[model samples]
Target: MAKGKVAFVAHCLLNQNAKVAEFARLPGVVSPIIGKLREKDFIIEQLPCPEILAMGLTRWWTTRDIYDNPGYRRHCRNLAKFTADLIEDYYRRGFEIILVGLDGSPSSGVRYTGSSDPIWGGRPQATVDQYKIVPGKGIWIEELEKELQSRGIPFPRATGIPMDSQDFDMDKAVKEFEEFLGESSGVQG
Candidate 1:
C-alpha cells in the first residue's frame, strides 16, 4: 500500500473566516498553496485556531506578551499536545507530514511572529503603534515545538504563508511550499 503525505496548515490558511476582524485576506482558503498541495497528493489537515478556541471571535487584538500568561499558555500547550500526538501517529504509519504556519501572526507565525512589547510595556497610548513582526515563534507554535521535542519526534520546520488585507501574495506562498517540498524530498531521497 502506498503511504500518504500530509501537511498540517494553520487554521486561517484554510479558512479565512477563522481569522480575527480585519485580518482575513481571502474569502476562503489560500487557493494557490492549497492547489499545489493537492496536486502533490498531500492530505491537508487544518490545525485549530488557538486564539479562537481560547478567546472568542470578538476577542481584542493583543500582543504575545498578553497571551503569554498562564491560562492562555495552558490552552496552547494542550492543543499542541493533541496535535503532536496525531502527527506522531502519522509518522509511525510511514506518512510524511509538514507543518505550515502564518507569518506575523501572534499564535501561528513560523519565523516572524508578532510582538507588541513597546505598546504593552506601559508606553503612552499615543506611542502604542501597530504590532511588529520579529524573529521568533508564536505562542502556539512554541508550545507545538516543545511538545514535539518532548516526544522525541523531530520537529517539522514550518513554512510561513503571509497574508494581509491589502496584499495576498499567492505566488510567494506557492514558492515557499515548493521549496519546503523539495527540501523534504531531498531528505528522504
Candidate 2:
C-alpha cells in the first residue's frame, strides 16, 4: 500500500467563514498555506471548530476562561479523542501526520493562544479588544495535546500560523507554514 502524508489543520485555516463575527481575515479559505500543503502531497484534515460546535456562529467574543468550564472541557476532550483516533490510524498505516493550528485563537492556537488574566467568567461585553492574547494553549488545543500524549503518539510538535491580527497576513502565514514543514523535514527555510 502506498502511504500518503497528512496534516491536521484548524478549521478556520480552511474556512474563514466559520470565524466569529468580524474576525475573519480572509474572504474564503487560507489559500496560501493550503496551496502549499497541496503542493507538498499532504492530505489536509480540517479539525472541527470546537467553539462553533459548542456555541452558535453568532456567539459573543470570549476568552479561554469562559470555555474553561467542565461542560466545554468535556466537549473538547471528546473532540480531541476523535482527532487522535484519526491520527493514530494514519500513523499505523505508515503515513506522516503534521498538526497545524491557528495562533492567538481561543480554541486552536498552538503557540500564542488567547487568555484572560483575571477570569472573565462570561462573554465579553465590549469588543475583542477588551481581552488580551497570551502565550499559551487554547482550550481545545490543550485537550488535544493531552490526548495525543496519553495515546503515546510520537508526532512532530505542532506548528502555528498567525491569524490573530485584525489584518491577517497571508504572506506571513505562508512563510511560517513553509518554514514549519521545512524544519520537520530537516530542510532549512
Candidate 3:
C-alpha cells in the first residue's frame, strides 16, 4: 500500500528554472524542504506553475496587481480545477495532503503576495524594487481554494516559504514548515 501522504508544492519550489530571470535562488529544487518531506515519507506533488502557464518562462517579475486581470484569473481558475480533481481523488483514497506555496509570489503565495505601485509595469530595465509584499493569498491559491470548496472538498492547510523577502531565513522557514507538517498528522480529505 502507498503511504497515502502527499504534499502539493508550487512548481518553482521543485524547479527553479520555472522562475523569472534573476529570481531563482537555487540551481534546481529546494532540496532542504524536499528532503524534509521525504524524511517524513510524504509523496511530493508539484503544482503547475501558473505564471509559466500564462506567460511562459521568459515572463518578467510582476506583482499581484499586474496579474489581476480577467484572462489571468480565468487561466488560474482552469488550472485550479484541474488540480482539485487530483486532490479530490487523493481525498477519496484517504490520503493526507498539505500545500506548500512560495511567499511573495503573484501566483502561489499562501499568506503573502506581491503588489506594486499603480504605475508599475514590466519595463525593459525593470527591477524588483517596485514590488511590495502584501497580505493575501496569491491568485492561484485563491482559485484553488475556491475550486476545492466548490467541490465540497476540505481544503488542506497551506504554508509558504519566504522566497521573496530580502532577509529570508532558510532555517526559520524550514522550522515553520516542519511544525506545519507535524500538526494533525491524521489522515485528511
Candidate 4:
C-alpha cells in the first residue's frame, strides 16, 4: 500500500489557464487530476474551511478568512498550516502526498498569482531571485524540505521559486511542473 496519501500544494497564481492547468496536472500537489502530469507540465487550486479553536488557534484567529492584516502575516501562517494539514490528512489515509506550491505575487482581487502566506514556525527563506526582487531577506526552500524530511516526506527543492522574472510563460511552467509532479507520484511511499 502507498505509505502516505498524495496532496498537492498548488498555488493558483497567474492566469486562469496556468492556475487551472497546474491543478489539473503537476505532482507534489493534491491528487485526482483528471489526466496525467507530464512531469514537465504545470498549473495549480483553492481553499478550505477551518474549525475554530483548532490546531494553531493563534493562527486560526490571526490567519486569513477574517482580516487582511499587514504583510499578510496571518495568511502566511494559515497557508503553512493548511498546506501541512492537507499533506498530513492524506498521509493518515496511507497515501504519500506532495505539496508543490506555485507561489507568486499579484495585487489582491487580481488573478491568483501568489500569496503572502509565510512559513510559520520556521525562519524565513529567500531564493536568489527573491533577494533581487523583494531584497533584504526571504523564505528559503530548505526549511520546508527539512520539515518534510523529518516525516519521510519528499519536499520540493525547486532551485528558483518561479518568480515570473522568467517572463511568466504559463504554458512552459505548466508543462515543466506537470512532469515534475508526475515523476514523484509513483514514489509516494
Q: Which digits, one per residue and each the tens of the lDDT, describe model 2 over residues 52-126?
A: 898979987777777888899899999989988887788777776787888888888888777655656644555
Model 3 weakest lDDT span, ten residues long:
118-127
Q: For model 2, what is the alpha-carbon lDDT of residue 146?
A: 84
Question: For candidate 3, lDDT tens digit of each residue in 25-86?
Answer: 89999998999999998888999999988889888778788788889999999999889998
How well does each candidate superpose onto the true structure, as a TM-score? 0.87, 0.88, 0.92, 0.41
Global Cα RMSD, each model: 3.1, 3.4, 2.1, 11.0
Each candidate structure's count of clashing pairs = 0, 0, 0, 45
Regions of model 2 farther than 4 Å from truth: 117-124, 186-189
- Overlapping backbone residue pairs in candidate 2 total 0
lDDT of 2 at 81: 93
Clash-forming residue pairs, model 3 = none
lDDT of each: 0.76, 0.79, 0.86, 0.35
**Comparing 2 and 4 by TM-score, which wins?**
2
lDDT of 1 at 4: 78
Error of 1 at 139 (Å): 0.6
62-86: candidate 4 lDDT, tens digit per residue: 2122223334434444544555555
Local error of candidate 3 at 179, Å? 1.8
Best by TM-score: 3
Deviating ranges (above 4 Å) for candidate 4: 1-7, 13-75, 103-163, 186-189
